[model samples]
Target chain A: MTTRTGPPAPEIRHVTVVGCGLIGTSVALALRAEGVRVTLADHDPRSLSEAVRMGAGLALAAGEPPADVVVIATPPSTVAAVLRDAQARGLGAVYTDVASTKGRILSSAELTGCDMSTYVPGHPMAGREVSGTGAARADLFAGRKWALCPGPATALLAALTVTELAALCGAQVCLLSPYAHDRAVAAVSHAPLVLSAALAARFAYTREGADVLALTGRGLYDVTRVAGSPPELWIDILEHNAEAVADMLEQVVDDLAAVGAALREADGSARWGVVADLLVRGNLGRELIVDAYARRAPAEGVELEAA
Target chain B: MTTRTGPPAPEIRHVTVVGCGLIGTSVALALRAEGVRVTLADHDPRSLSEAVRMGAGLALAAGEPPADVVVIATPPSTVAAVLRDAQARGLGAVYTDVASTKGRILSSAELTGCDMSTYVPGHPMAGREVSGTGAARADLFAGRKWALCPGPATALLAALTVTELAALCGAQVCLLSPYAHDRAVAAVSHAPLVLSAALAARFAYTREGADVLALTGRGLYDVTRVAGSPPELWIDILEHNAEAVADMLEQVVDDLAAVGAALREADGSARWGVVADLLVRGNLGRELIVDAYARRAPAEGVELEAA
Candidate 1:
């Protein structure tokens, strides 16, 4: 391995984004917007060609020199394999990923015996209600959190290069360990996905629920928006992050049980307190989320809590 | 009751809205936009005056002639009492409400022995992340579902007037029995709210979860947005609609249990299938919600399903 263990390069002059899905295409476009030479690659030639037609990037020739950075934005299951191939080919000076789960990807990289010094497992805290390369946008990462989990084996220059990539894409860079990243995403992302799914799934088979689905205001609409993602894609995510997600989901299941008990009560005050407690806690979480989302736009004057 | 019973009116021109909260002020502003004579009232003089200054309406005088309609946009617990008092004082030709629950409010009117012919219980499928009169906007109900649950005692004239009001406010009017309305809202709106809160609450007390909360992407953010609603307000809603909300929550709790069971499995494919099944169902539900939300703007070309 070429030891470029010094300060970060000033800029990522040439980059290659593998797997031309939503995240890959978006990253390529973002990097391209910053006047970087971006190259697109995917197993599906048509997919990569379409991304190129959209001006995302040109296809990297087989004989092209190693890029300054390589972003593997493929499915979680294939991340380690793709990274190994890229490393075998000496594809870039630095390598990173945009998978939702990091623990599994990192472990897979280890098991596959890839060059670890160049790999920094990352996940962008951003997405839309829709997916696919067709839904990609250059500004997808703008002002969103982009977690960078640099392993002990990671070289300082490689970590710095990924940091530069995030900044150029207008993302707030966050440092997290692979294990820590997996657990955090499990609690807030993975488990919440299942929670939203289960709730929305209830309406799918229940006619009474469907009859009034239209009557639901923005509240239900917002709560279930993420449930629209392609099922097979989520299956891939959950399969890799199952254990951590299940742990977080187990706790939420307990909370639901408590809510059920409270709702069954005929006593108004008892039921009111249970609902209020959970809701108050939820208000705290929501505040944390909304504030973190805007970075600089903190909300104010929110004083309504349970009496 | 006055002998005013016939087909739906062409339009409702004169209206007064009580409560001076988010829903009340929004209704007043929407009515004003439709060239209707709108009056505002509330127990809090400062609130009503603030709404007036925002041009929501002029405050209704103690001795002014009754408007064509009086909209009671109050908390669920007090809707019946306010409606009864308004009916006793001959406040308007018809009365309606914008409470979230229907069964309890209807029961309260029965308990108070109010004149019910001029009353139509309505629940607008509209809200925002923020609330109160300060956050009121005239387009709050635009293109949203507005359910009108008229009892047998409801006069045709009264129902027609309310329909006109909903139409003028750019809402699509729906009809249901008060009992049916309560159950429907409980299934689609109320239960989903608790589901969001329960999922969010898990993250609240979990220190590990908090560390990663900022790292989460849009999936968690959308699922928990509704959990930010004022706790006291939600407590009132949950109390009034506890039975129905609880029933729906019971089903969701069971679904969560299923997910947890499937997640505990060691086999990746087995767990993957379960996640896929639930996520597929979720996709169906999400489509239903999205289609119903935008009247003429149905999404298309979404074909990715579980493998």
Candidate 2:
């Protein structure tokens, strides 16, 4: 396999993106904008056509490509299968998968006897409320953190090539073990989805909640926005990262119990103290997240309306 | 007390606003912009001076206001006490409040033996993340719902006068029982505060969460935006509405348990079905909120950025 080096080199030529969904289409658009030859492929013929129309790439039939890099941006449950199929078909010199849960992808790839060295398990920490090729943007990954889980066969040249790809898309690249990546995303992303779904379900069962819906404000909108995500996508995510998500859910249960006990005792002081502690900690957590994004790419004057 | 009908007879009359904080300052600005005399009052000397500089009529001492309408914009914990104190001093001909939790406000006013007829338990469903008079904006309440919890002494003249006040400030008037208002807000507003706080605390307790913080995206940011709200304010809200909040919390716990169990069993089919049910419900809940807000005042061109 040919290797590329340095900044803005002619090393990167043709790129093949296998899924043609939101993330895959987005990656293809970003690459095409950088003047790379992009090939779009998908089991769904409609998605492939949509990706092409969205400027992701030209529709390509299944076969080996004379491309430098291949991106597998399918759902978590299908990531391993797509990776194996692409590798067996000799799709590209270097390949990567943009599945949220990385550990499962790597494990499944191993079970399928796919080459690990030539493959990188990656997760782009960026997305929108909407899905499909329609939501794909060339700058979607700009200034966001992209986690690259490089296994043993991940040559330094190949890893650097992926990093360059991320940088070209204006994203910051971070390295982590596949296990660590999956666990971290489960805690921050997957667990929040589950928690939000639970909250919405709770409101649905309450008589007062009907009235609450009438009085809804930005507070509720912010907290439950993730609850509106596609349910099937979340099911795939939760099933892949079940252990980590369950652990977080149990912790949440303990916290809720303590809060309930404090409120039950009618100790205004204790209740306030407990609730205040949790809120302050939440503020700190949020600050940490904001700081991370600011470091990667400053928001650059995105004015937010007052809450 | 002399009550005049038909829009204060076009007189440049003074309007006294108690508390001189975020809501009060905003109200003062809104009223003053309409060429009305606005006298600001606050126990805090600093807030009093700030309100005066912000175009409110001369800062009044702690005495009866020589004005027509008085708006009490103090914190929930202090709403009743302040109203009672103001009424005892014969502050104004008609009075109202902007406290968030209303049932407790009325109950406390009753305990203090204040004339309910003269005081209206009002809450404007609008705010900013930042607090204090400095953060106040004249257009803060524009196109938002301003709920009026009228009492027995809520004469038609006074109600009409306040309704005109709401219209002048670009807000839609909503009248409901204080109890119903409290129940609605607890589910949509107060309950989400506790839920977000709990999620934040749980995230902070995990090592993987530390890593995830650096990879945060818009989803996490939107979900936890309210988690940054001042803890003291939430404590007061939750303490006053503990029973309602407790009930909501219990339902959330039940839902969480069901979701966790389904995922743990690797029951993808069941998990997907359950989450689909929740997503559908959540979509319904969101649509109801959007429609209500749109009906109150069409949000045709409101472009709010991510919080």
**Any residue pairs clashing in model 1, and if so which?**
none
The TM-scores of all predictions, comma-separated, are 0.89, 0.90
Expressed as tens digits, the lDDT of each residue in B1-307 for candidate 1 is: 2233445355677898989998999999998988998888899998899999999989898898988999999899889999999998898989999999888898899889888899999887888768889999998877677788888799877887888788788776778888888888887788888888887776675555545666666677788888888887888888898889888888877877888888788785656666788898998887887766665222221111110
For residues B266-306, could you state the per-residue lDDT of candidate 2 as single tens digits? 55465566656655666555555545445545332222111
At residue B103, candidate 1 shows an lDDT of 82
User: Could you tell me which residue pairs clash in candidate 2?
Assistant: A117-A153, B117-B153
Candidate 1 Cα misplacement greater than 4 A, ranges: A1-11, A205-210, A296-307, B1-13, B203-210, B296-307
Query: By DockQ thresholds, what CAPRI class is model 2?
Result: acceptable
Error of 2 at B250 (Å): 1.7
- Cα-based RMSD of the predictions, in order? 6.8, 5.9
Off by over 4 Å in 2: A1-10, A62-64, A202-211, A298-307, B1-12, B62-65, B203-210, B266-268, B290-307
Instruction: Compute the lDDT of residue B3 as modeled in candidate 2.
Output: 41
